[model samples]
Every structure is written in structure tokens, then in C-alpha cells.
Target: MSASDSSPELSSEIALLRQPGLIGCLAGRNLSAFSSQVQAVAVGWQIYALTHSAAALGFAGLAQFLPMLLLTLPAGHVADQFNRRRIVITCQVIEASAACLMAIASWQHWIGAWALYVLVALFGACRAFEMPAQQTFLPAIVPVSLFPRAAALSSSLFQVACIAGPSLGGVLYGFGADTCYALCAIGFAISALATSSIRLRFPARQRQPITLESVMGGIAFLRRQRPMFGAISLDLFAVLLGGATALLPLYAEDILHAGPVALGFLRAGPAMGAVLMAGIMTRWPIRHNAGRTMFFSVAVFGVATIVFGLSHSILVSILALMVLGAADVVSVMVRGALVQLGTPDEMRGRVSAVNMLFIGSSNQLGEFESGMMAAWMGAVPAVVIGGVGTLIVTVLWMRLFPGLRDLDRLDDIKPAD
Candidate 1:
């Protein structure tokens, strides 16, 4: 399409970005994505340096994710009760400090597997709190009417950073891994400042004082909601099984014969796809059969993963990964909007935290599983089988949660008062 042909959609999206609060939120997201990529490279290199084991690299990933499983509930409760902007800035400061600690260790040549592991564990713990606050605050920035478009735009910007950050990290590593670590620390500082700038108009709390029972009630609420449960679980298992990210270093060196630059591109492929899909979603909202679309998108994700696993050619592998990324983003957008529309305003924070836990846990645990499975079956076979597993799980999930597959439109649903 010509530039003029795309002008209307681009114009609409640009208008959304012009909203001061949304811009601030996007700034925060951009910095976070950059920091995440730098951390990925730093951890990948450190593990590869210490143990030279793909499994160990996967364990590094586990260190980051393990906290989400343990702290996600409390994080949700805190987000519901507190100032989300303050919460995000606080976490960013701590996360920045942690990155600096790792940089110092790398500079002194004192870094080891255990030290990196410890730092990542700490990082994960802080992130458990940060994510819920970040997500819960988005709807406050943009009006409820703009959420579908705004969410797509925000997710797209994050993916843009995902593409840029790793590619830059790969370039920076030529100087030294410590350089990348230091840069990531700076990224966190920027994230803190950006988050501090956002002006949130949160709805006043209607519930009584925060309590353990109230938080647990959120979990109980989820248990009774079948469509929400299915959507969350589907992404969790599909991503867990289909994840090949933790193994990118191996693919770069042993399989594709690419250097750090190529590894960066490989890592960024999915984000590139996600950005593309996000752009598409902004103009054309998915209105009907939302559940079925999610299933098909994820199933396509599995197919793309299978293609990526079997391909050794750099171009082919990148294409496969890009396809996978696009498919996953579609599912992500649909499911996220579904959760937002389906839950009550009072319950948004707690429910969002629950949804995020599964999503966040899946990303981390998927890495662990990928690393362990790759160690046993070797990378190619491991990835291929994981893709197959994702497909099977999707089929079973569809059968088990027909409600999700039957969802028609976000406009038709109403949150309980």
C-alpha cells in the first residue's frame, strides 16, 4: 500500500500517542523493553561464559521468572491499594541498582553463574510487583472507549523497543558485556523518570482496607470464570511449550553461524512481527468470534514455531520467527482486551494481576522448559516437539473451554457491578 493509503490509520494511532498520559506510559514501556533485551543478552553471555551449557542459560531465565509465581498475588494487592506510578518508579530504581551491581561484578571479572543467578532472582521479585501496576494503570490513562486501540498502540511501541534494544545490545557487546549492563542500568533510570511523569487519575477505592482475604477473593473469582481461565491458561501453556527465545544464543552460534549482531536480529524477529500485528490491530478491531480468533492465532503460533525449529537458514528462520511473533501478538491483544472488558472496574487490578501472573510465569517457565528440554533432545528436536506440544494443548484447551471459543465481541460483554 502507498503511504497515503496507510495515512488514516497512522494518523489515528499518532493521535492516541499524543495523549500526555499515554505518551508517558509508552515511554515507560519503551525503556522497560530496552532494559529487558539488554538483560537477556547480559544473562545469555554470562551463562554461556560460566557453564557453556544451554541448560544453564535456561536456568538463568528461570531465576528471572521464579519470582512471578511467588509474588504475583501480593503484587496485585499492592497495585490495587497504592499509587501505581509510585510503585513503578520504586521498582525501576531497585531494578536499576540490581543491574549496576551486576555491571560492577562483570567489570571486576568477579561475575559467576551463582552471582548472576542471585541478581536475576532479585530482579524477578521486583518485576512481580511492577507488571501488575503497569498494566492496571493503562486504562486510567486512556478513556475506556479508546482501550482497544490504545492497548494495541502501547503493545506495539513496546515491541518496537524489543526490536531496537536487543539489536543494540548485540552491538554494545562488542565493547564488553559490562558495557551492555551499564547501558541497561541507564535504561532503568530512564524508565523510572518516565513513569514518574505519568499523571494517573485512578478511581477512588470503594472497598474497605486492603486485606489478605480480599486478595484471595480475586483468586476465587478467577476460579469461577471459565472463559477467562481458558484464555489465560491457553497462552501460558502455548508460550511455555512454543518458546524458543532462551535458546537463541545456541541457534546463533551453533546452528546459524551468526555473531552477536545476528543473534540480536534473531531475538528481535518476534517483536518485529508483534509490532506489525499491533499496527494492524489499531485500525481494525477484532469484533466477533474473539475466542475463536485467539485459538487460531495461537495455533498458527505453534505452526510458526515448528517451522522455525526445523529451519537452519538465517532468512528462513527469521521469517518463521516473525510469523510466530505476529500470531502470538494477535492472541495477546484479544485476550487482554477480553479480560479488561469482562472484569468489574473495582476488580480490575486484582484480576489483571492474576492474568499477568499466568502470562509472566509462562514466559519464564517456558524458558526453563526450553533450556531443559533442549539439553536432553538437542535444540532442533526440542523446539519441534515443543511446537507440537503447543498444538496439542491448544486443541485440548478448546475442547475444555468452549466458552472462550464462543466469545463474539467485547462490546457485548459487561462487567458485573
Candidate 2:
């Protein structure tokens, strides 16, 4: 068969690389990802330095996610109804501008924990709008046949950025916190500029009148899909419980006695593992007992989290976190496929919004939860307990939702009616 006629096994990378605007789109995403990682590492260290309080650090994390919860429905609707490229560019400008203000604040030595949190909250709001808009914009520009490749290329680039961003961010942060913030601002602006340059005859999807009913369509659809709900919920609680990322600052300060540079490597650990695993998965896709694979991956993630919490050696901790990241990436791949393949084109925006809502909140909310738990039980014990809780949740989810556990193939799981 011709390359284009090949089934899903066609080379997605080649197909996407041949496309025009895709390269620009991906470049923009890469730049954004880099800046985000830089901002994250710098802000985390700064918060710890300023407040010396785990709860305050958690609140910083909370500020980023709160917008995702509040604006998910409307954000998705806007992406679907409006010019997604314009929406995305506008949001990028907002984020870039916020980063600029943050940089100024740092340079002026005026940003305390509260000021930093407010800036981060603004950054989060931009992400709330940008994600859904950018996501939907891809399919509009690329041919439908090349979409699978587009997805693969996008995933690979994002993962690469995840690995590179922190390492670069950490190094830049060594110059100064202000330096890090400045880079974030510059990076976001560049990303916005690149995205704006992508000229395509892309058409936005059909829009509906803004109504509470129209906005809530995605949630209502997700409600009836047992496997989707089960998978997403399981991921939500597992991640929320297993997360030790927010406590990294504590670990660096108290346990490992590492500096910000070491913290950058530590932050990059999971992404490194994920990149290694993802490269292999792309070559040999998951085809057997997919549901079982997800459960196993999450279970592995829990165990790795425990190992990370207990380790005193920086190398061991980084290794453990790498394993945790690798496992989580597997879960990410499986769950993403389940969600995207099952949703129709028209509802894709809303469905994506719903997915983003769950995923984004779990991450930042998990950070907050980690902070509270660490404040109460101590970082080591808090992480250990959370890891254990993840294992327990895994077992309970498998039992409570047999349909999810028995999902042997992605092909068998249909879209919501």
C-alpha cells in the first residue's frame, strides 16, 4: 500500500514534517513550554525563599489552576466559536505581558509571595484560553489524513520541551530570579509571534449561541461515558494523591541539601524518563491489554513516588522520580487516546475543555494538597502517605469500575452518544 493509504501505522512524523504551518505551530508550542518551565522553577524557588512556608507555595500552585476550573466551559466555547488563532495569540500576549510584569517585579525586588501568586494566577488564566484554542487550531490547518502524525509530532515536541525547559530554566535562574522571569517573557512573546505568522485557510468550527446549556454540553456528555469518567477520575485522584512535585522545594532545602541548579535537574527527571519511554512507545505502540497497561503504569508510579519520598541521595531521588514520570507518561498516552478518539469533531472543543479541566486541576490542586499534607505531616511522611494512597486508589478503582479495568483495546471503546 502507498504510504498515505497505510492504516494508523503510517509514519505520522513524516506526514506532519511535510506540512507547512505545522512546523510553525509546533515551534510556538515549544517556545511556550520552555518559558513555562523556566517560570515554574524560578517561582518555586523564590516562593520558598520568601515565605518559608509550604502552604504558601501550595497557594501559588492553586492560583495557577483555579482559572482552569472556573473558565473551562466558557474557554472551550470561545475556542470553538471564534477565530482560534486570534484567540490563542491574544492569550499568549496576555501571558507574555504577565511574565513581563513578573520580570519587572523581580528586577525591582517588589514581588513577594502574594505578588508572585497574583502574577502566576494571570499566567494560569492565559493557559486556560490558549490550550483549547491551540488544540483545536491544529486540525483546522493540517489535512485530516496527516492529523495522527500531527498529534505524534506535537506530543514529541512538547515532551522534548518538558525535558529541556527546566534544565535551561534552572541554569538561567542561576544568573538571577529576575533573569529567569525575563526569559519567560521573551519566550512567550516569541511564541506568540511565531504562531501569528502561520497563514492558513483554516476554518473555525460552527458556533452555538452562548447559553448555559451549550457551555455545559461537554460535561453532560462526559457524565454518561462510564469508561471515560472512570479513567479520568482515577487519574485525577491517583495524581492528586501521588504528587510530590510541590514538595520538591522542601526536599531540596531540608533533605537533599541541593541548590536551585540541582533543583532544575530534579525537576527535569520525570520528563527525561518520559521522553525515553515515549520514544520507544512511538516505535512500538501499545496494542495489548491497554486498560491493564494503564493500571500497571499507575501502580508503578505510586511505587516510584514512595521511593522518591524516602531517598536521601539526590541521584536516587532523581532516578525514582524518573521512573514515576515514565509510568505517568504511559497513563497519559492511554488516557489521551481514549478521550480524543472517542469524541466527535463538533464536540471536540468541549470534550477537550472538560479533559483539560480535570487534568490541569489535578496537577495544580495536587500541588496545593501536597503543600497542606507536608505542612501537617512533614514532607517525607506526607509524600510517603500520598504514594501509598495512590496505590490504594488504583486497587479500588480497578474493583469499582470493571469496565475501565477490562478495557483490552482502544478500538473497542466507542465515543459517547
Show how many residue pairs clash in every candidate, following the order shown. 0, 1
Error of 2 at 11 (Å): 4.8
- Model 1 Cα lDDT, one tens digit per residue, 112-194: 89988898899889888888888876766665667788888877888898898888888888888889899999999999999
Worst 10 residues of 1 by lDDT: 408-417
Give the clash count for model 1.
Answer: 0
Candidate 2's residue-wise lDDT over 1-417, tens digit each? 787687655566566577778777988888898889889999999999988899988998899999788888788887667777887889888888888888888889888898888888888888888887776656656665454345555666677888788888778887888898888889999999999988755455565798998889888888877777788888898889999888887888789998888888888898888887777776556667888889999999999999999999999999998899889888887777667767765676787788888888788999999999889988999899999999999999999878778887654545556
C-alpha lDDT of all candidate models, in order: 0.85, 0.82
- Reference-based lDDT, residue 410, model 2: 57
> Every model's Cα RMSD, please?
2.9, 2.8
Runs in model 1 lying further than 4 Å from the true structure:
1-15, 18-20, 206-212
